[model samples]
Target: MRNVVLFSFILLFVLLIFCANRTTKNESSSLQSLYHHAKVTSHPGYEHIWPNIEFGWEIIVGTLIGVFGASFGSVGGVGGGGIFVPMLILIIGFDAKSATAISKCMVTGAAISTVFFNLKLRHPTLDIPMIDYDLVLLNQPVIILGISIGVVLSVVFADWMITVLLIIIFIVTSVKAFIKGLDTWKKETIVKEEFVKHLESTATSSEDVEYKYLPSCPDDEPQKKINQGTILSNIQWKKFGLLCFVWIAVLLLQIAKNYTATCSIKYWLLTLLQIPVTVGVSMYQAIGLYQGKKITVSKQDHGTHWPLHLLIVSLSCALLAGILGGLLGVGSGFVMGPLFIEFGIAPQVASATATLGMTFTASISVAQYFLLNRFPVPYALYLTIVATIAAYIGQKIIDRLVNIFQRASLIIFVLSFTILVSAIALGGVGISHMIEKIQRNEYMGFEDLCY
Candidate 1:
């Protein structure tokens, strides 16, 4: 029944694409011209205040908040867009749309830094690189597909509706993460006590009591160990090639989308092409995992033990999380981080893997924003650099703390805290904005994408 339902969903999406293309020849040029006018005359986002703000002390204060947000978000494997967007809008004094673009710029920097660190690092117990490449291959494409859907809905849904949904989802996900963290902390305590007792009974050295699953490493680990050569060798090129192919395919499609007339045959054709690219690639990976031909190596010996249903559910979760991110204007990291924990992944590997995929999506966003000329180059560049440094430092500090305390649950706590803060901050911002829109007697109904 579930497989049938899932298949039907994909089929429906495909059918819609074909249906649009079938009317390609019937679409009149005048209709196309009207759409072109809409694209030129109106902004896709809700609000864009005047006065050309984003200067002065705003930059200094925004930079400070960006540093804190990047560090916390990076350490927790969330993209920190929740904090970045609000900071950009309120402190930096940018409009909503530009704030989102610059927010992605910050996310791109942080994700790249965190992913680079994870690439040359090993899993806590497994020999594989800390990132779960197979998981990325399976999850990312569908997440992108869902994001496209969410973007469409974002255009149509009123601000208040999205805000209410965001608050509910974030709060629920955060509570679940807190509970998971408590469970993990208790388990760690029991293990620590047992290890100490065993050492006393056997008169063993502390080093001999090191657990197989702990991320224990020499404190003197050299930076040179993660040089270009080591990083290249650590990567699984086959999986990476597939991931890159998906990224490039989608990127090219979006570039093509810009040249075509809005809502025209060419535009719809380009838009619909993404379905095959995203769903096709994700389906390929999902099937491979189900058939035991591939694995999420960070899962240790249990990688190949996944049932078909579990694979379907995971792909579905990725889609759902991606859609939520799109609707709420938050990063996928906020949703994906907690979801990965629930998938029973170790917090260390989960954070790394989620951020690895975020690197791809964030880069895509930055590229699109650049194409749209949405932000000033100097500001974006400066913020990006700040985020990169902050993320790198944040990851290092978190790794040190976790290892010192032997508590991976710290990452989960950070994830929960970040989500909770986002819920309160963003929810409040949206509610206030919604009230303002109401005061001005704005339309609160479905928006026309064509207009």
Candidate 2:
């Protein structure tokens, strides 16, 4: 089976190059005409879609995506689609739909490489119990369901549906961000005396403990205090309620807009995106464990009642979120990571679980996209091979600098988010000309231009 798969991929790669070249030759004139039209139409207004050379900048950008995805995935225990999809759309001139499709295709290589690297290193045990086995079984059915839905939608109304979905998602994300900012400001302004008093008492108790005592001094002398910081109470129920309400509102909006169909395709793509990101997250966790960082485990088990039910629910919700993220061109782990955290999973475990879950999501997505003909088999194969190889190299570099560069992943996430949001806002107004001109020199041929 492996040999067959490899041979099939090789044949596909050759076919993709041949087709791309043929298309370039035959369609160059038409493409040039479209470019001129794009220039004219885009002068006063911005276009959501732009054109560029597929094999030129796309390859370079795609490689960069693979590298970053591998590097961060090594550290974060999540796939790098959150980084890659946005980069592809904003930097590589792919629309969100095409970016999602290509990202799904590309992530396979990175994810596979990361997983193999982690296995080779014999990283620390997951420590989370039988969650993996449970997930493996539960996820397959949900994924199959999602793929069935996505394949139908992709064939029937992919382009139009994606455009409409993007618009709604943009508006919702903007509003959610603004609201979060406001809530943060509100929380900062409020002062809770009870919370403060609790913190003070906790601090006092922690500080009274001693780590060591001097032997030369008086034996009866008081030991020096060791200060362990206070633990704040869980967030207030009112605030939690408000947050839940906001989430529900967002969910309702999505449902009313019938965007669930978009998730069908996205869910499958998410499985592919999970590969490298999960390995990265796992590696980081293993390093933390090696350094004696405590790992948390949930006491709840998959018993016959609520515990089992909750596990199933959590896994299902995660699967759905992964799909949604893929459709949104952000990747599955970003959304899954936070959701897992919210469900009282330890942060590291949450990151790891999300990444693992995403692997399944991405695998299914890649297959669905290929089946739907959204990606040509040859191009997909070439991309997969290149990205996978690059991911292995990238992971080696990450392992060498793990201690120093783990935090860099968070910084990259923040910066990538900023760039994506900025691109969306600016692209909505057609400001690509400024970005393109500044990033690339004038008089460059179409083949040389960054989309």
Candidate 3:
């Protein structure tokens, strides 16, 4: 079965590449004369969708797509930006860059909703909040800094390059997530058997059982004297404050960067200022984790001190995730979701914590996009509200499902499936646009960030 699944993914990837190549060839042959000099309509980009607030078929269709994407994306911690960008372009009639900007808005909405839902919950077995505040502190600052770098780099890389890169990265990540889900599923099965046997032994033998191996069983354990207020009160306020500090510092620097000339001394200075704020916070957390002062409660207990290499590795993954967010116009949660699982964090905690961090970076991305005038206010607002509501609903349903099945692998599978769907959707749209440009004999090279 595993071999078959691997082969299936390989086949699907090959099929997408084949279609892209064939689509390019067919466009060349078919539209060579039909659209001489191509004169494709120069869409007024955001203005095309902005001024007209019509409740037409397109808006209706877009709302449906946004809701589904948000529901699943929120559950998977991917913020559905991968799905949102393509829907905005194909159905909603926004240009690619505009679609990317508005996609960030939807992601921000979903991430915010998911984070709110997660905050009210606790770790499956540990006496801590499900949202790992330490993990967020260690990763969020760098994720924000990485995003700053990616957003600028986004302009320099051509659209087709991003599309192709998105396809490759999403597919690879999807496969990894799926495989991790399978392993987690098997582990859950073993845990289930042990739990059942322990129950039976206690019923018949009456011998004192040590409960030595029931680590993952408390997933469905009912909360004791729990409410929204306590959930909020129990959070590590110091870490949360540091996270907000990095967020505000980066936001202010970005806002300042916009006022300066692109690539000017002041602009570069403002950009460089972001690094110290982010690095200082992450390094502080890393040192704490190393000296056993702070813990990634999702991955550690009170006495669990992390190795230096693992600390270095976490920082590296944080950097990669940050870069991925900037390149993909999505939250870094998509990467963190699976990475947390590999670090021995439960899938439930992984999804929650990743989304919490996503809330910060995605909202920041939305602010930056807005500052760039990349999205229409009306469209962004409407779609954001839609995503927000959908995310809340999704969280409720998924939480119930996890409790009922006692299988946390469900979230991992959702993460993988969403990324896979994004790969196909984004790849198709990108290839379609690339073909049209090829037929039009337009430039297909890197773009000027300053321009």
Candidate 4:
């Protein structure tokens, strides 16, 4: 086991190095092309916020954000970019386009590192239902349509809409958070009948069940217990249907909202965060389906329909996530996470699987960005190298810190959302000033002059 783990770590490290080198090369080449073709007056926007935000500071903030995002994602079975992207755009002066691209790139590095760290630590079983080939086959057209539409929109309208949409998302998310907090406080003070009824419903769903199976062997020998048919028949088909419908509706709405938001904000960072948050919330609902279930099946039925169903659900979610990630430059794990939970996957397994899916989706997005010449080479190279190295280091630190907080998962998510809201409220360092500073380096001493 130790040898296997060590080998895995070494392999991941090597892969990281290779990916970093390749990314660096591609980014450098892209940068040169951008510089040559870009209008001399257009000046790449790197220097506008350079003086106000030091490289060290950016690295520190980026690393912390990655760590927080990774830790939350690891525990909640979702990607943390929902928080990271908004924070970067709002707090850092990155335009919507640059922020989304960078957020996806950063999330890819962090997710890969987090998965490696968790696997090395021998995290418990993550049992995602196998992808349903049938569902994938059935939904391929819808998924394709969504992806094609998203990609076309991304190319045509992503630039103008991302910022404005981000501001709106920020306001809405902030209001939601503040209201949730208030509700929590209010609930503590008064236990209304509705609240009590809701709690009772939740508790009843979480209650354990008792069952007994009849002996299968003949009386000639000692009787052996056989799985009861009653148990299988008792499967809550209605509840399952309800759960599936709720999650499906949530997933569709989230995708629609995300597409709408991306059309407006065009900032990849905020978009990255929004999509994953939607996925995570969806996963939370899925987990409820398996909260208190005991299934003892006969060997014959043990592997029958469940795996197929799981596979279909997982694939449907994963494909949707990948398409969105590819088109919008965010991790698709948001969609995958909830689907895994709904399909009866364990939390840790769901998280690991979701991260794995995000890794692929983010990679595709990065490749597409490169092919489309959406990234400037020097900036891409610098940011990718920095993010990758930092993510590796951050993962180690996050693993160590994970033990300190009992509810670290929930805390990390709340904090991530809070940071995002605050950043969005800040107006991404103001649009006019951002354009001016990028066009001319006049803002270099503005901070010091103001002070």
Candidate 5:
């Protein structure tokens, strides 16, 4: 089955590459037409979508680059937009705005694809649920609240500011992943040593009628099991209510902004429609929680404490992640998943639930961009298709590799390396741009930083 999945992915990738090349050959005129239409018809705030024209190799490169980004991203349950945006800017020579727009589209597609993959692979008996719907529900309101605020804050933060922020986030996240991994590795080693000492002691002791092995601590459990009732019963109602209030407030603000600006009915309608679509999943999960549905905890989380502090920290991280991710056209999962693991959520739960949040957030971000007509239609379409496929395959590849290697240290090391490289690359770009701005004395719409 593994071989078959691998072969299928290869075949699909090759086929898509062929299609991408062929499609680009004939898409120049259509792309030009789309640009012209968007320029003439798009609202004032979104004029940045209509860029100068290009064709041929650029399209292929963009698609191939997306494949690489999505594949790398899937390993860590990220949407690959971090890699996508940087590559588009420095490597592909796209302006920051265009790269962000395209990256949002790419993240949207990749997230939805992975969500579908999770759904398709879910089995009540044979397989553990990759996505934690209840957890996703419990967390979605806060995440949505964050994304909403982040989208608003995005405008206040200029391109350079956004770049600077991303650089900081990348560096901090890298350090956290490194420290967290090292700490966990040390704890596991100690546990293993203790287990071995107990075994040796048992062998030497004459009082033992039957040999009994020392059980590892909960932190070192092989699999996690969540207490569904406890999780549902202990829904941080105050925080949850606050998040819900924020969600509603943001929605109303959007409506007011649209109405006062005298934007088209279409924009108003899209905003209204988004509420139900975005919140519907959470509502459904809430209903399930009330319905007394059976909660399936994984092997690792069987008896762990679901603390209020954990919820607080997770939601707080989501808030910042949403803001940075929205501005930079990346998924919050890049930061959120690691934060979850750091906060004592099992790795699988962290990855799965963070992915669920990403899907919704990406959907919301994509819709906002699409409604504004800020997306590059044809180019985004191509990148999205390739990214979607590559992300799924990338995740599978990581899972298989994990099973084969069985080394937590190696996984952490690789993740740390990836994050470190990302920080350097993004920081380098931001610093270079800042230098140019300072030299030119053109700090667009901001006071002098020297002051």
Candidate 6:
């Protein structure tokens, strides 16, 4: 029944794409003109809507691309935004800002949906914490700091800067994934009965089992609790208070900017009301943390003193990932996962924490992008829904096969190789585009690529 439902859902998506493509030639040029105008025209009352937006082959292809990217991403325990952004730029003819904005929205939606599933997941025979809230909160502050910086910088820079940075990020990540895949493949081998026993043990045992690809802390060691006297506990008030003030300030500025732009009174009013809703949620969490009700770190992990070096490295990586993620319109989950492993976190815990952090980063970045009117709002919601659903399906399939799949290394290798090839292709196109734009000494937008 589950398989049938999945197949039916996929078929519906395919049918829509096929029908949309079949009528591609019938897309009126006037509608195409409208799309181009809509992107650049800051007309106060004009909201880009259906019929005014170009709907044809590109969108269909883009949707399919998102599905494929998200499917592989979920299987590999990565976010799809990296692939989504590049493909949107190279194939769908979207500008860098637009691609990043839409990709961020998609990632945010997927992360939120996946988090929901992870939290609710229950096994009749197996008992475990599926979503590690403690680990997530531990990483949130630093990750949020990094993401905040990234979002500000993303909007501050020129589109070309983002494009160039994305090329570098893609190439580097591809190489890393390829190397990691080889290592993972070599370490995992299929032993049919052994695999079955392990799965059974996992279901029956309360003890943590360590797999080569997914390691756990020693079973003898008790899970650590946060030290009440730690700096994290003492400084929560300052931290949350500062964050609240900054976000509120930013919200006010956005409202002011909207008014100054002479946008419709409705636009500014809506922005004033809508922006606070998100900020309020963040502030609420911050308040909880400030009240010492949240555990942000473990005392045992720090011993008698703070692990300054660990803190520095983790935050630095997060900050760097944030910049890359914001510029590329991704959460950089693959990158963060390895960093978490290096920090000696369990694979399961790291995955959950990374999802939460990615969710926050993507949400904040997309919100900023939306304020700047960088997103294609009409298409964003639909595409995000599709990607989120696809991610959930892909995750479920991978979960069922996790214990049985012995050739994990081979799977990773193929996926990494494909990502590498795609990166190279995207890099080449980006470089060539940059060269042409530089030579012409002119600013060209996505409208130039309209068919």
Cα-based lDDT for every prediction: 0.78, 0.43, 0.77, 0.43, 0.58, 0.55
Off by over 4 Å in 3: 1-51, 204-229, 301-303
Error of 6 at 435 (Å): 1.9
The TM-score ranking, best first, is 1, 3, 5, 6, 2, 4
RMSD of each candidate relative to the true structure: 13.3, 16.3, 10.3, 14.7, 8.1, 9.3
lDDT of 4 by residue, 232-348 (tens): 342335533433443344344444444343345543443344444334433443343224232212111422333445434644555555455445444445445444434433333
lDDT tens digits by residue: candidate 1, 1-451: 3563355346534533543564464455462321111122135444443212222366657778987899899988887888898888787666777778888999999999999887777777666677888888889988887777787789889889999999999899889999999999998899888877888899667655656546664452332233213688779899899889989998888878877777789988888898899899989988888788887766554587678778878888999977877777677777787888888889988899899888888788789778867676656776787788778778878887887787999999999998888888788889989999999999887778777
- Of 1 and 5, which scores higher on lDDT? 1
* Model 4 worst lDDT window (10 residues): 209-218
The estimated TM-scores of all candidates read 0.86, 0.46, 0.84, 0.44, 0.68, 0.64
Candidate 2 ranges with C-alpha deviation above 4 Å: 1-58, 73-78, 86-97, 121-131, 136-140, 143-309, 312-316, 322-330, 343-349, 393-451
Candidate 2's residue-wise lDDT over 1-451, tens digit each?
3563466457546645764685577565564532221212211353334344344555556656655664555334445554556565666555555556667766656666655554333111222231232332333334333343343343444333444454564445434434443443343234233334556767566335432211111232332011111112212244224323333332333233232233456543543443333333333433433343423233123222234345456546645544444344444554444444345433333434444445555665665555444544544565566566655555555444422322223322332343345336434423444346547755322221112
Model 1, total clashes: 0
Model 5 lDDT per residue over 171-282, tens place: 8887888887788677656755765687676756533432111212224323212211232343436434544454555455554544443335665554455456445544
Query: Once model 6 is optimally superposed onto the true structure by TM-score, how far is the C-alpha of residue 281 displaced, in angstroms?
Result: 14
lDDT of 6 at 42: 38
TM-score of 3: 0.84
Model 3 over residues 277-330: C-alpha lDDT tens digits?
999999998899889887776676432687888888888898888987887676
Per-residue error for 92 in candidate 4, Å, reads 4.8
Model 1 alpha-carbon drift over 4 Å, by segment: 1-55, 217-229
Q: Is candidate 2 or candidate 4 better by TM-score?
A: 2
Give lDDT tens digits, candidate 6, residues 1-451. 3974577487656756654664574455463543443354233444432222344567667778887776666544456766787777766676655676787788777777666555553211123344444444444544554454464465556556766776676667667766766655555444445655887866655445434333122232322111012333232355435444544555455546445534456645644553344444444444454455543342225323334465455556765775565454456575675565445443344555577567665666667667777676766776787678777776565544543453434435434554554466556656777888889897644321111
lDDT of 4 at 123: 20
Q: Which of candidates 4 and 5 reaches a greater TM-score?
A: 5
Which regions of candidate 5 deviate over 4 angstroms?
Answer: 1-61, 117-128, 187-307, 408-414, 445-451
Q: Residue 150, candidate 2: how far off, in angstroms?
A: 6.8
